[model samples]
Target: MPAWSSEMGAAMQVQIDKIFKEAAMQENIDDDAVFQEGDGVLAHLKFSFTLSDPGLKDCPLIGCSDGFSELTGYTMEEIIGRNCRFLVDPVPQEHVENSARMVAREFCIAVKDGEMYTVPDAHREPWMPIVHRDDGIFCIQTNARKDACLFKNLFHLKKIELDEKVYIVGLQTEMPIELWDEDQPEEKRQDACRAACRACHKNMGAAEQVMAKHFWFSSPMRRQEDGNDEDDGFV
Candidate 1:
């Protein structure tokens, strides 16, 4: 996974806004028309914000579609204002440290009547294995009690294979800085910090490689000749 470039992120946001605006227009036509039962179009969940707010500590779920309730066990009342990330268990600190340290958020969408709709919540339980489709693509259903209605809906809308594996990979939100204790010797603490910084840089580079290979995006990780950039590399 690789971090999205500023231009790419802005482009995506524009597209997403168009989708939501169309959905809103449709809603105005008929309140009961959006998520009819058995429509086979997975309902979309709409939040107040189109993009994630980096400054906020947590992203709250302000509103969701009726289809969201149908897929998840909880209704809008239970889910609204809660962090959507809660659907899946937290990633362990050790796992984050050992892996590429990138978080890949998944979103499923469908186009109906020339309007694009997206599912609000799509996450698999931490315990379940990633499911593979006949086409060799991997998928993880939302940890909801109901079946994968959203996925099924998306498949129905577009007969093409879905690439759930495509991820907006970026640095892990929280780093394991606490792994070093203050009581440790100054030299030992400094060494540990250096090691952690190196690991972060390595993970970031790996993520960039994946993005470049798969999406044809240029690498965002630039090597510094001075080597002082290591101090600012703790992601």
Candidate 2:
């Protein structure tokens, strides 16, 4: 039996519904679903429209599940009612602006621009996307190295300064390890040449791994001068 009364369930569902419904209607969405369990409920929303401008005022519904706020150094409130472009530097405003125009036409573009990029594992090849929105915007997304449209597999190591600290980010190849069954003896299968599987592993140590691969965020090195970096006290 469920712990909460039907009345409570209805009210919670209402809260969830209102939020998503409001989001979809005001922003770039048409329909959404709300689920209820116990005292809390969850909402999975999808916007039907392409957002040329992803601002907080347009999308107020959010969650702190992954501590993205701390990672990007911005509170949820600040992120809300503002464009995600805040993640980009003011100098790159032109690039973001042009990308927005592309989305309006619904054309997928993967240009090797040195600005917007992502590195999901914070290593390997960054995934950059030519964004085409239903509402008509063309944006690129990447999850690999830096603004360079290159990967660790092909490009040499690069140096980046963050919060006054100078660090080198590069590609290093390491063997992949897989767990094997100890209870059963190893057998030579038709497609198996070796018992252990070796593949590529993307690893980041300490400071290099602090930033995420794909999404954009403000870095201390974006503005701080080299000699004056020590005074900033950023990690």
Candidate 3:
């Protein structure tokens, strides 16, 4: 019997809660946001759905949350048509392959639109699997605030259908150090966020990989990468 991520019912609920909470903390939302998922996270969930064009190379952001706006200091009109990764300043820690680490960093810092969004080349280790079912790409990525200050974000990317059109959604929250005094040193915040990223990632493995509520396509899902549009399926 093959398993799928859709079977993760209770876990889904927890993911939703965690996602909302993560977003709430970053922009300094009220405590009420802790339970209700903040103000703009849900409304701002749908991101760049431009995956329709095999010709278009980059994934653009269609919308974002108010908390996101607060955290990055970007207005809706300004960010509506840019690659989400433009905000990224990746801090590489999980290195399966040198290529994977480089790709992650390049996608975040170097590559232009559509360039970094592709899956790893067939010859390399597929370290960055886009876990479709569970919570998408749950990682601790550093993004530059509008003020040019670097901040850590609990980033998430998921693909969904809307009006028969497919779009990739992005959600981000500034995770805070739990139980640690705000007066604590900056290093502690890094430790807390790193731990949070690890725990979130750990939950997505195991049985959940079988369920793979992640994605399904009739003709294998292929994406355009660096050179000729070659791919080994899902990103």
Q: How far in Å is the alpha carbon of 150 misplaced in model 3?
A: 0.9
Give the TM-score (vs. native) of candidate 3.
0.41
Give the alpha-carbon lDDT of every model: 0.30, 0.25, 0.40
Q: Which segments of candidate 3 are over 4 A away from where they belong?
A: 1-57, 89-135, 177-235
- Where is model 1 more than 4 Å wrong at Cα? 1-55, 90-102, 105-142, 146-235
Model 2 scores a C-alpha lDDT of: 0.25
TM-score of 1: 0.24
lDDT of 2 by residue, 81-110 (tens): 343334443323333434333231222121
Decide which is better by lDDT, 1 or 3. 3
**Model 2 deviation from native, Cα RMSD in Å:** 22.1
Residue pairs with backbone overlap in model 1: none
1 versus 2: better TM-score goes to: 1
Q: Which candidate is the best by TM-score?
A: 3
Report the lDDT of model 2 for residue 151: 14
What TM-score do all the candidates reach, one by one? Answer: 0.24, 0.21, 0.41
lDDT of 3 by residue, 145-193 (tens): 6776665456544343333344444444565424235676655454444
Candidate 1 local lDDT, residue 11:
39
RMSD of each: 22.6, 22.1, 14.4
